[model samples]
Target: MRLSTILRGGIVVACTAFASGTALAEDLAFTLKNATGVAVTEFYLSPSNVNNWEENLLGNDTLSAGDSIQVTVADGRATCVYDIKTVFKDGSNVDDRAINLCELGSYTVHE
Candidate 1:
């Protein structure tokens, strides 16, 4: 009986750790830019990882010309998908020019 209990407990702990590791797990930085040469009162940055978009980086709703907003993800992951947008400045859109500051980090699990 004691052995069975120990085994069950061990399995539960392992599963819990795995589940927690995958929950909202990601890491990256985002920056928004204004390519319209105008002040964007509302701006946003949408970022996503391999198969998750909702959990990605979502930016604010406002930004000025030449101004940018930044956020860092903590899971230490990189995403190739991102969007920069103008939230509510009239004559603006979700499209904007951007310069990637640095390459995304590599996955530790793959290597």
Candidate 2:
């Protein structure tokens, strides 16, 4: 299915009919878009109040520029606010703080 994208700023949240089909507590999933013109070697989302980065969401997969992936929070953390961290293949990293994952349908990361 083709999902509509939300373009606001560096961190965007889409509001489409497909996105509202899931329940927040049962399915904490969101789309992650890569637009940094680089391969994302790692992706992480940690609770806003947490001090350390969570496990790599991408695992062994790499997200190239213009690509997107579905990220699901199955660890049982129900917090809407999170800090995102993306590590590029060139050993570079970018961090976006205090993003509401619950309200976010799709998050597009831009350079």
Candidate 3:
């Protein structure tokens, strides 16, 4: 099910940036910690085998350094592994491959 966008403290948070009240058994929910010492301006995920990254999960929001947010990936796909991409406020970005979301309860973006 698609969740409605949420606004908290004046920031627009999309479903991928935060978990809904309930979770599906197939959904992958995990805590995203920002440890890169820079604000994260966007987050994107696509199945590991996919060539293109999905849309930004943050919408108009940003994840500041040392902050954490619960993120949920519910794209209706059976796959559990994904390629992660995060863009920082300074325009630099990081790309990671083959992250098994179902087995990962938490992910930290650092360095």
Q: Whole-model Cα lDDT per candidate? A: 0.37, 0.72, 0.74
Off by over 4 Å in 3: 1-25
Models 1 onward score TM values of 0.39, 0.74, 0.75
- lDDT score for candidate 2 against the true structure: 0.72
Cα-lDDT of candidate 1:
0.37
Poorest lDDT segment (10 consecutive residues) of candidate 2: 2-11
Question: What is candidate 3's lDDT per residue for 7-46, written digit by digit as tens?
Answer: 2212233574357654333556778888878998888878
Model 1 Cα lDDT, one tens digit per residue, 1-34: 0011000001123465577775433445444444
Model 2 per-residue lDDT at 2: 22
Q: Where does candidate 2 clash, by residue pair?
A: none
Query: In candidate 1, which residue ranges exceed 4 Å CA deviation?
Result: 1-24, 45-61, 73-78, 96-111
Error of 1 at 54 (Å): 6.1
RMSD (Å) of each candidate, 1 decimal: 15.5, 9.9, 9.1
The top-ranked prediction according to TM-score is 3
